[model samples]
Target: MPFKTKILFLCTGNSCRSQMAEGFARALRSGDMEAYSAGVVRHGMNPLAVKAMAEAGVDISGQSSKTVDDLATKEFDWIITLCGHANENCPYFPGKARRIHAGFDDPPALAKAAATEEEALAHYRRVRDEIKAFVQGFDINAAG
Candidate 1:
């Protein structure tokens, strides 16, 4: 059988955006693609990300934060960076990996800036839904 495409989503923190993207991609692509996420630093999975993904009907409660070093040996068909700073800082991944950047504002940072928890969750929901829509349309194989 042909190998399923492997995709790695990346962010600086591995907390919010990359995790959410992994959840979204799993929901949309399922067996068609293998989705993984990692960060430059292991900042732990963000609670807001879990909550936001739950609202989207995709449970990411089991995913953990991973560092780039942890994933150094794996080869991905695509490397998608979800934050602007991360996109700039991302190192080259060997193999035929096609790198793509789709930067989004950090929802956790927005939540921190908000006074109410409800307001923070609202921001996360918006970001989660937006990223879901964006990733749904990506054609990783064609981009290479």
Candidate 2:
């Protein structure tokens, strides 16, 4: 019924952090924000990310993995980068989309040496919660 802020969560692969941000935003801030996510390049959805989000009662399995070029709309109120690669390589949007960088650790990379599935998932869970908190606490109006 009121104005919905448009946000784009950008990441390197669209596999984890950005997806988590988008999911958390959708589940937690849907009343006031329309969130979208994409990577500089598509790495497809990460299964571990899905599992981690499910554990938190959020479903991110329905979201897609694609490049920034894939989004139908280019305008956004905020373009938040969830990783360094995306932050450095983010494509320009012609609108008044204010950009912000909030880098998060890559779960898959962090779990690379993990000896077991549970160990690997630990990384996902941690990053997922971190992203959720960021999405919940971020003040879009604070961006300049």
Top candidate, metric lDDT: 2
Each candidate's lDDT (Cα)? 0.89, 0.92
lDDT of 1 at 125: 92
What's the lDDT of the predicted structure labeled candidate 1? 0.89
Task: Report model 2's TM-score to 2 decimal places.
Answer: 0.97
Question: Model 1, poorest ten-residue lDDT window?
Answer: 135-144
- Residue 33 lDDT, candidate 2, scale 0-100: 88
lDDT of 1 at 10: 97
Per-residue lDDT tens digits for candidate 1, residues 43-66, read 998887898899889999999999
True-vs-predicted CA distance for residue 41, candidate 2, Å: 0.3
User: Which parts of model 1 are misplaced by more than 4 Å?
Assistant: none
Candidate 2 local lDDT, 1-144, one digit each (tens): 899899999999998899999999999999888999999999999999999999999999999998888985668999999999999998889878899899999999999999999999999988888899899998877845
Off by over 4 Å in 2: none
Error of 1 at 77 (Å): 0.8
